[model samples]
Target: MFKVIAVAGSPRREGNSATLLKAALAGATAAGAQAEVVYLNDLSFRGCQGCQPCTADDTCRVQDELTPVLGRLRQADVWLLGAPIYFDGVSGQMKLFFDRLHHLTNEAGQLRKMLPGRRAAAIVVTYEDKPRDDYREVAQRLANYLGWMGRFDPVEVVSLGRLGPSDAAAARPELLAEARALGQRLVEQLAQQGRTDG
Candidate 1:
């Protein structure tokens, strides 16, 4: 069975980003994949210290609430990352979590230690009434980072705009449906690749 991990970067548990992530996880679960969601706001963790220990050992030395999360990310076959745009970027929690991912590559900037052939989805929620190119670019940049660091292939991006209210995503069935479909597609693609490999 494939394991899927969803990380929620919003401080609000029922916020738009977390709501979309939950919907996606539901789809993955229905598709016969084991899914789990991690709420960053609930966890107490610090940002990466930039000690560069990972340069030689290829591991994050700072042990905290995020340690186990990093471990699970390495073992999971699929990743779903959701974050709300805070001041034109990902939330502080998400940005800190991303900073620790430096261990995925070596000091030479070459891809070093990461699971190969995995899949990922970048979910970004913004409060802007009209989605800006910069917002989409943020999601795309996140997708690119996951692809480069985790060796995820075909990283899908889901960008939602005009979500000023915490329940905005919950109120929109179509948005939830879209997220669910994306999750299903990820699992289906993985299964197809497994069959092809076999």
Candidate 2:
């Protein structure tokens, strides 16, 4: 079975981003893939300290909640990142998660990456504003960083906008469908690559 790691980067419980992430994980299961969702809000971890201890083997030395999670991330075939936009950028939790991923890069300035093998990833972002290019940089930069880590181009970027309590992405059928499609596509791509570990 292919394993997918879905990350919910929202601080709010049952928030729009988390809801869509769960939907995507459901779709992955329907596609014959095993998936796990990790909620950043529930974890007790700190941002990277730039200690460079991972330089020896690319293992973060923080020894917090994120340590084991990062280990699982390295073993997964696919990754799904879900976050909410805050002030035209990704949520603070999401930023911290990404910051901790510096272990994937062996050298400063991304000259060398230690993470072995390429994996597929999808990005989901929920925003309160209308869909615009201004907020796209965050996701795009994430994709670029994953590329630097030897991961495949981000399989999808789902940006849901005009979101409020009543207009949550989960409540929007079209957006939910998009989330499911993203998951299905990720599994299909993994199958095509013969990446199933089971």
lDDT tens per residue, model 2, 1-198: 888999999987588988888888888888998899999999999999999867656778898999889989888888999899988899999999999988787765435766565568988888888887766767877877887665564467777778867337657888788788888888887777765222
Tens digits of per-residue lDDT for model 1, 37-92 = 99998889989898887867678999999999999988888888889998888899
Per-model TM-score versus the true fold: 0.92, 0.92
Clashing pairs in 2: 1-198
The best candidate by TM-score is: 1
